[model samples]
Target: MIDQDHKLGVKEANLVSRKLQLSGIQGQEAEALVAEIEQQFGVDRVAYDPDAGTLAFSYDATHCNLDLVESILSKRGAGFATNWWNRTKRSYYRYVDQNIKDNAGYEPHCCNKVPRK
Candidate 1:
């Protein structure tokens, strides 16, 4: 696990990192976007590399996911690049986030804890 402090309301076990190549981000204006994302409930960390046009962030999948982040980006006139790799990754991210959410409340019911003779 990465040695870093997560933001309030973030669960370490549900933490997830995402790195996306974004389009239409104005230089310096990304700071506003970053600030907005940081204010979200489960966002742990966020950074935008203007030169690479990439946005990297970590959040608790149980509370925040890519869709929420994308909404904020869309409102700010930024979005993921339209490319095969990006699309594939975005789909995977969504799948994993959904899975995490689905399983967040699940509990294992195994008998391994029973005392042996």
Candidate 2:
């Protein structure tokens, strides 16, 4: 017997991220970095500034976790210009963001999604 179901389509929202400072990731080098990140499953959009050494990206929180994003940079040898303390905090945030996404099964960083009354 053939199964029948209606309304099978699902809609997912794109999540945007704040400017993430990356050291030595500006200019031509950024092209490769962006290309690699773009290939990831969660990544939807990316913006890189050559002078400021920052990258902004959009991704699906579930499939694309924070560590995953950092992993891309770390493995590529892209350093963070910030001091140790800030780096630690940023790392912590990434962990928390991943947890939030996994728990809710929603977009990453939860705050990006506007609340509905």
Candidate 3:
């Protein structure tokens, strides 16, 4: 299990660890690095499914409605794929604005789709 004190939640911790791995940090040290982030950010919920290679996080359970998570998983493949990183490079504010505009009245559901490996 991941360290709960880390503020990054589950998904962000996983993403940070992955990025560290890509940058040459591996094994326990990588885990520690992510934990540090969690301590700083204060994650409320985190889920890492090795089978799907996905990491998910939310500030609180209520904020992470099932349908929204399912939408993110469906739209983006498991793990931090190349496309996922690429999308992050676009204007951060733009995505936030778009998400706000698009997600109005959107009700999320739990994902029942087959997990990716």
Candidate achieving the largest TM-score: 1
Write candidate 3's Cα lDDT for 11-99 as tens digits.
43222211100222334543443443334332354445444444444432212332343334344332234455534632352354346
* Per-prediction TM-score: 0.89, 0.64, 0.29
State the C-alpha lDDT per candidate: 0.92, 0.65, 0.38
Off by over 4 Å in 3: 1-34, 60-79, 84-94, 97-117
What does candidate 1 score on TM? Answer: 0.89
Tens digits of per-residue lDDT for model 2, 1-117? 111221112114324354567885647778888889878875666778876667777666656666777888888788666878658867776876667566665445577778877
Error of 3 at 59 (Å): 3.0
Q: What does candidate 1's lDDT look like per residue over 1-117, in tens digits?
A: 542566688888899999999998898779999999999999999999988999999999999999999999899988999999999999999999999999999987778798557
Instruction: Extract clashing residue pairs from model 1.
Output: none
- Which pairs of residues collide in candidate 2? none
Candidate 1 whole-model C-alpha lDDT, 0 to 1: 0.92
Please give the distance, in angstroms, between residue 41's alpha carbon in candidate 3 and its true position after superposition: 2.9
Clashes of each: 0, 0, 14
